[model samples]
Target: MSEEDPDLASRRIAHESLTRDDPTGWFENLYSAAADGAAVVPWDRGTANPLLTEWFEASEPNGTSKTAVVIGAGTGWDAELVADRGYQTTAFDISPTAVETAQRNHPDSQAQYVVADLFNQPAEWQHAFDLVVEIYTVQALPIALQATAIQKVGELVAPGGTLVVIASARAEGQPDAEVEGPPWPLTKATIRSFASAPDLRLIELDESPSPSNPTATRWRAEFLRD
Candidate 1:
């Protein structure tokens, strides 16, 4: 089907429906469908998030061989960007299709792409990373599952490491109207849900204009594991 086809838009909306709740089965099924090469995810922009790239360039994490993990690493744009910054990066997605595509796209990069569910990750990954980048991954799950996702993010960062989350921001006091989304927008409070973790401290939380899509506001928060 053509990218602009009306049927494609309908299918995109259908894919988004799987995120309405923490429906692991539904998500697995959706990914399975794509595993055989079925649909193109609407959110795959084919480029690194400019804001994240800017942050990494400016911060220059001060050490060689730092390890970074990208959660829900759809299309691997963010992962590639981080890896390019000299961090040993691992990018994971629950969808095998997405992981495969990322590997194919970044053949020369040292980024490791894997298929892993964030909700139920292996124990070996706990506290294994010096940097964690979460972009539009938490809100992709149901609101009730948001905290669990946040906790897992915290678990991935080693002490004194950084956790960076980039998410679409909703206006204050916005109600949860019936909206279909894989790009589930979040409020400011929702973004801070992980900031107050006992083992982590909020270092910086900044919202800025989205360069590629200015219609949506974006938040980039950084936390340091204590």
Candidate 2:
């Protein structure tokens, strides 16, 4: 038999969480297990996501004196990069263990890492950031919760600020029932829906081959709030 998939533990936990109607409750369970060395965080790449890095290179955003927020910030890689660009960064994760791990992983990092649920975000965070970075966070949730999650993400962007979303792409025609996932990949239509809010406008949406899996596609979309 083939070796067991490394992410199976996370998937199993997610399944149980979803069955309980607590879609996001698996995050803390998985992160806590990973902290005890009983499981692994399959998505913790230890470096900034390549899609995010590509955006930085192509846009050359000057974040100096500006504010940025990383949604579902895992172990701090993306947050560190944002901070490196001179943005006053706040990176938050629903899992307290993940937040603590991020702090431990980057001891001298400048980003303010916190434990915050996207659905119950602090009032001060609404429309508070000059730049909002959401990488794979939406897709990680159950498909039914994606729309609300996307809205919360968009609400973080200040007027005139930008929101960048990087996610594994699913063809628009693909059936959701066929996709087995803790990550139900985002379809083109769902990606475009990020701009449905009155305050948000879709600026650009690019689909490219995933760096790690060339056969798979990834979507990098940017939105601006009016």
Candidate 3:
């Protein structure tokens, strides 16, 4: 949220859009603005997240080649990681412009870049992917919509597969009202809530302070479906 904080007017518009019932269009708008050179895309690190890199690097590539989907795939760096590991990766963002940007970023990418809303994912995707990589999309949403977002994340997980999540974390007792943000970080309670679905169970969860902000922590969670 630090660098993503654009000019005051732009931030206001984005927050207003999220507070509405849709609670999601602001991402597309923000990415469009960034594309038009109005603001910067703070999360577009142009490289894979270290947590993801470490997770993959430390493990043996043992899973059979199966369908994988990257939610909020953005510019496709993380999707590339999954693809490199031999997963049939399908990376998606809510914004058509963002998907186009991702495709342009990785011209030879094996990952299929598409614009798909998490809340309205295609019916064919239910229980379809072997691995679901969702990073930061929920915290980027207002808390009001995060519950639905959580459910959508679980819905994308196929039986006997896994879901990988990385998101900004909040400490105990930090009220959402205290933080006015388009990218409102989640508390540990919120992070664990994604495991509430009976179909999924948390296998591992890690918390650490953000490298950029010592006060702000982040969570990397892995869930498995039984």
TM-score of each: 0.85, 0.96, 0.92
Q: List candidate 3 stretches off by more than 4 Å.
A: 1-10, 19-21
RMSD after CA superposition, every candidate: 3.0, 2.0, 2.6
lDDT of each: 0.76, 0.93, 0.84
The numbered model that scores best in TM-score is 2
The 10 consecutive residues of candidate 2 with the worst lDDT sum are 1-10
- Candidate 1: tens digits of C-alpha lDDT, residues 1-226: 2345433543454465554643444444444554445544555677888778878787877536789899988778889888877888889998776787778888887899998989788798898899999987887665656778888888898888899998888886877665345445788887887776767888788888877678877999998888
lDDT of 2: 0.93
Model 1, residue 28: what's the lDDT?
Answer: 47
User: For model 1, what is the error of residue 198's alpha carbon versus the real structure, in angstroms, after optimal superposition?
Assistant: 1.9
RMSD (Cα, Å) of model 2: 2.0
Residue by residue across 39-109, what tens digits does model 3's lDDT show? 77767777998888877877555545788999999888999999988899999999888898999889999
> Higher lDDT: candidate 2 or 3?
2
Models sorted by TM-score, best on top: 2, 3, 1
